[model samples]
Target: MSRAQEHPAPDPAELGLTSDCGSCFGLCCVALPFAASSDFAVDKEAGRPCRNLQDDFRCGIHADLRQRGFSGCTVFDCFGAGQKVSQVTFGGQDWRRAPGTAREMFEAFPVMRQLHELLWYLAEALALPDARPVHAGLRGALDATERLTRGTAQELAALDMPAHRGEVNALLLRTSELVRAEVPGKKKDRRGADLFGARLKGAALRGANLRGACLIAADLQGADLRSADLIGADLRDADLRGADLTGSIFLTQSQLNAAKGDAATRLPAALSRPAHW
Candidate 1:
């Protein structure tokens, strides 16, 4: 990891981790590939623009994506990588205006997305009072990752993403341990478990480690998930109705957007309730 000078930690709110499509150049619509799954209506190869994308780089069915068989688009979050690439990395020169750079730009989008995602997690870790012991490490990782986001397209496309992600994941895991330890009793260790269609409604999963768990379509209604580590958990179609996720760590908006929830589902202060829920 790159060493950064000691400074105040980056505020998660100020990092622009949320997607701003208006400032973007339809990168997600063009750079990403989607299959004819329940999430997408049709297949689209990488570097190909979605049919719904407009000349002005706006989604033609943005407000009605879920109703239009493009439910996957609603859950996809670039973590502000789109605008960062369009405006900063590429200096606001869009792919249409500079076709020569389009391929490199497309390749760099995913890489930048990963870096931004790590920044989001690190920033969240820094805010946890129980994770104070590892705040220094978290801040350093956040700084390093943010710097990586500003690299040229060539540098980003050639980055060793897995190695960097592993390093940041270690720090996040340590932070999770510190925070979850505050919860009494033996916490569940369900990391990377395959819990597809699980009937875990009302399960007591407080302080549980659920990192990278495949929870697709699981019946998780009314589950108590306070203080649980949910980094990288696939929650697509998972039932979150009446679930209390009040202090859940690493739960992103995109994850919630993918799940089935209701007005009764409690969330952390950092996340908002999805409209479709």
Candidate 2:
């Protein structure tokens, strides 16, 4: 059966205007592994079911994961990857029915998740009034990322995600530099500056405007971003292992959805970590 028939049509609100997690097979919880931590407090391997996941694949502690000591569950967002992989990509062939497909499905989940995340950002960039100058480029990139998501299972399975991510990184970097350039004293203003690969461990950026900053590969292990404006920051490969982004304004879902960070990565209450991360 096709995904549409098996999973049913998605509601806009559930998908977060991009991808929905409810229409998924709990792919993130099943396909990805997690270790014991203050966030999770348990160890699970890839393709294994999370202890909190019930027989129907719903989180057993859905209503009280935080109070139940599974604080990690409170901060996870799949960016719609779970539904895309379970329904559209695999055509609703679940792991239980086709156990042999588990490995491939697990591998494909993260790959497609990253592509969908890029789509999210590209879509957001197009909607930005200040990013008018880069609209054409953003649209082009968005189209390319969207097309990539439509690749066949074989093609997606063999994709070199790191390399593809690098290509997209370049375009995102250009967009950031172009948009932030319009601000006065662009060089002097650290707000929204490209800090890719810069060593900023333990640095202070309280109340600073970091909108559209490119933080790819930057060392932000303990930097403070509280109350900072992180509207369009590029955090791909950025080491925000312990960086705090509480109260940051204009920090969109697409930004966190695309970036790579761990449980130690502190986020605004509005956003959460990707379940598969």
Candidate 3:
């Protein structure tokens, strides 16, 4: 699990952004597809239950997943979509019990997942102090997004998530600008830089724009990255110990999942410190 904490201690307001595996019906294990690669021991098709998935919707080898070559499962976080689908959308119905409804249920899982992910981002954006300028809009968007989550399965499957995301992204970008402006000095616009394996340890990157940057295996230990814009930044294997990410924009759990960090890595409240640190 990248040595990240086996379990995440999430913030109270960010509850919907965290996983509640116990309340879920193992939707991810059943609805997601995995290829036979370094992350998985065998290939599995979408909607097919994993061999290790227990009858009770738990991983049979949860504690031994890594040793059993199921590391890919460890990195995935459905952001509370699983339970919302299983308990709320499907009314606690398991796919096994209602085989006829399996296809729609499986398809709606991804759709609701995307919607819930947007809620996660929107909730975080609304809480940012610098985002006060657009709180009303963010709140409206949050309400709308939350409403979508409660829609019928067909409505979610037909949802134009890209359109909704576009609207929310515009507000998030504004929030980023406002937060970065708090720091004096011209923000470095390094969006989409190919910094693969770059050694940037302890670098002064506060308020830097690293949107979509390729930072694979980069050494960024102890770097000052407060208010940095990290939208879509590829942070796989990047060393982030002791780095400060306060007010950093658009940093997702998935990005953090792919990176290496320690206890000293200061993260924004929306994200948690990985246990591996």
Which candidate leads the pack in lDDT? Answer: 1
CA lDDT of each prediction against the hidden true structure: 0.93, 0.68, 0.83
The per-residue C-alpha lDDT of model 1 at residue 90 equals 96
List candidate 2 stretches off by more than 4 Å. 1-19, 186-250, 254-277
Q: Look at candidate 3 and tell me the lDDT of residue 91.
A: 93
- Assess candidate 2 and give its lDDT: 0.68
Task: Assess candidate 1 and give its lDDT.
Answer: 0.93
| lDDT per residue (tens digit) for residues 1-277 in model 1 | 3222344557765887878889899999999999999999999999999999999999999989989999999899999999999999999999998899899989999999999999999988887888888888888888899889989998998899999999999999999999999999999999999999999999999999999999999999999999999999999999999999999999999999999999999999999999988
Query: Residue 272 in candidate 1 has what lDDT?
Result: 96
Clashing pairs in 1: none
Residue-wise lDDT of candidate 3 within 2-91, one digit each (tens)? Answer: 212442222434546567889888899999899998779999999899998888999999988768888777677788899889888999
Question: Which 10 successive residues of model 1 have the least lDDT summed?
Answer: 1-10
Q: Which residue segments of model 3 deviate by more than 4 Å?
A: 1-15
Q: State every prediction's TM-score relative to the real structure.
A: 0.96, 0.66, 0.89
Q: Which candidate would rank higher by TM-score, 1 or 3?
A: 1
- Over 68-185, each residue of candidate 2 has an lDDT whose tens digit, in order, gives 7676565556667778778878888887778888888888988888787666556545544555666666667766776777676788988888887777656655555554455444
CA lDDT, candidate 3, residue 185 = 88
